[model samples]
Target: MIDNEMSIEELEQDFWGEPSFSSYVVTTCHKARQKPIKDLSYEEIRCLIGQKIGLRFVLSVAIDILQANPLIDVIYYEGDLLLAVLRLDLDDWKYNQDELKTFISILQENRSKIENFEEVSNELVNKYLQIRL
Candidate 1:
């Protein structure tokens, strides 16, 4: 039986359309905030991120890309920018490069629409740096 959990190599082929980059880099700035977000706990951050994910379709698209291809992995950052790195599966990369690119393109296009998105730590002194995720 074909394993549902495709390897990273397979995913890469499915997405990039070639063995190009090991991973796809997606960097985005949060939506404008009335007051810059200050230091927050991991839980708080997760909640905020979740909110963004729901509000923004890009998040869903990203999730779909990962779900369709398990070889792809995601990394999120809570600093000045919301960055997500997707490690493409070889198969996915090869088969769906346009789709993968489109997904990321949408994220980049709508990044400016984030109204409450902000960094966990602004200029203020945030004691919470280490978050267990």
Candidate 2:
């Protein structure tokens, strides 16, 4: 069980194994916010994916924030692969293989419209918030 008192930094260190990766994830998220994700180079996307660390960091922070504030419904990653990390307890919801395939298809079809992480997240929320399995 995670302590409620733990800071995001502490959680990152404990869950992700390095505090520095948290900084990197934040910096990358900032950049994503400032620019279009579609404009980012493959290398930049690769860096944000960061051998798994970046996505994990982003998901961890998103989970922490959503636990306190449920208004936000999703966190997304649009890179070499696209993923929608829903802000719900794992016990409450889990996507089935068909749903996962549908999401991936939707992502691929709407690639041009999703210009940033926010767009990716919003797309998922708009499409999948009511879906459960």
lDDT values for all models: 0.31, 0.40
Which candidate should be chosen as best, given lDDT against the real structure? 2
Q: What is the TM-score of each candidate against the true structure?
A: 0.23, 0.23
Task: Kindly give the number of clashing pairs for every candidate.
Answer: 27, 0
lDDT for model 1: 0.31
- Per-residue lDDT tens digits of candidate 1, residues 1-133? 2222432223223232332434322111122111122322232223333434211212333434433432222335332222232222223334345544554443444434322345322211111111111
Q: Pick out the ten consecutive residues of candidate 2 with the lowest summed lDDT.
A: 87-96
Candidate 2, 31-90: lDDT as tens digits = 543333334433334444443433423333333333343333323333223332432233
RMSD of 1: 17.6
Off by over 4 Å in 2: 1-61, 69-121
